[model samples]
Each structure stands twice: as structure tokens, then as C-alpha cells.
Target: MSGEERGKRAARNEDLFRQVNERLHDLAVISGSSEPHGKFVCECEQTSCSLLVELSAGEYGAVRANDTRFLVFPEPWHTSPEVEAVVERHDRYWVVEKRGTAGAEAEDLAERGSNLL
Candidate 1:
């Protein structure tokens, strides 16, 4: 696949994972859970990845402040260097910012709330 196509695909995968995490967060809030941190799945490009990262609501909110950014496991393998860059490194997870085509696609997905079904 072309680079742009690959970037788009990666963006879609990451967005889907983000949606799942969002739903889990919402559910936790509705259930009145007082847990300080939640286990969110790694929002990476790889569909086969099932790794989970723990983050508090505030930390996840920081990542969500930018549409192009995502929370991923703090390992090199969870990041796609071609379409994203590691912006922040934490103990259990890393923040990645999508660039180029991937950035545009991620922003679009966030704005439209599309491709979640």
C-alpha cells in the first residue's frame, strides 16, 4: 500500500481503539466507580495489539486535548514511526501524535465521530 493509504488505515485502527476506551470510560463513570486509574487498551495502529495501559481520567484528557494524539503502551513496538511520533513518555504508557496524513485522518474522525461502527 502507498504511504498515504497506510497512514489512513493506521489512523482508522487507532481511532477505533480510542472509541472503545472512551466507551469504557463512560461506563465506568456511569457505574460510579471511584478507581483512580482505568485500564485502557493501547491505541496503536496494529489491529493485533491487545496491550492495556493504565491512565487516570486527567492523563487521558491530556492526550485527548489534541485530536491527533493517542495513548499507547510505552514500548517501541506499539508505535508506528512512519505516521506518528512519541510526544510524551510515562511509566506505563506513551503519548503519540499523528503526523501528515494520519494527523488529518485522526482529526477528521474525532470531528465527525465517524467509523465507530
Candidate 2:
């Protein structure tokens, strides 16, 4: 491709990144809500690629998988290489961001226990 075309592509990618951030904030509002009537975390981006996502704003949060809660997730998310990859996947078309507490934290508070992780 020509240099000019590449530059435009990069600019477009940057805009998508901003959109992802905005979508994350919107999803946070829904995910952080007290009720679970409808889904709040919808995939924000849809691509011709296999992984299609919807950016939603309301639903139950994922605090654990299987029987585990309180996962030791890398902090800041931005500095985590794997996480950054998820966010930059599809050549910047798919960006993943997280907000709010994990499931284990909620469960712990309910039981009046400390979050082990």
C-alpha cells in the first residue's frame, strides 16, 4: 500500500481506539448498576473476523470463571502485554477494556470476608 494510505489507516485506527474507550465508560455505567434486568456489557465492535463483539451497558459482571473468583489480574490493564494485545487485536479494530470489581469481591463483601486475591 502507499504511504498515504497507511497514514490514513493509522488515523482511523486511532479513532477506533477512542471509540473503544468511550464504549467502555458507557458499559461501566450499565455493568456497575444495582440491577441485572438486561445486559450492560455488550460487544462494542463487530468485525468480519471470527470474534464479533457488542459494546453493551448493562448485565451481570464476570467476577469468576468456573468456580474461581478473585483472579489476580494484571493492574492498569494498559501495561499488561496480553491485555494490550486483546485491546489491539484485529490491527486495532478490537480493543478490550475492563471496569468495576470482580465477582469474588462482591461475593466476599456479601459474606463479610476479605478478598483472598
Tens-place lDDT per residue, model 1, 1-117, is 999999999999999998999898888778887899988999998889999999988898889889999999999999999999999999989999999999999999999987565
User: Lowest-scoring 10 consecutive residues by lDDT in candidate 1?
Assistant: 108-117
- Model 1 alpha-carbon miss at residue 19, Å: 0.6
Q: List the residue pairs that clash in candidate 1.
A: none
- The per-model lDDT (C-alpha) reads 0.92, 0.31
**Model 2 misplaced regions, further than 4 Å:** 33-47, 50-117
**Alpha-carbon lDDT of model 2:** 0.31
Residue 53 error for model 2, in Å? 10
TM-score of each: 0.96, 0.26
Local error of candidate 1 at 12, Å?
Answer: 0.5
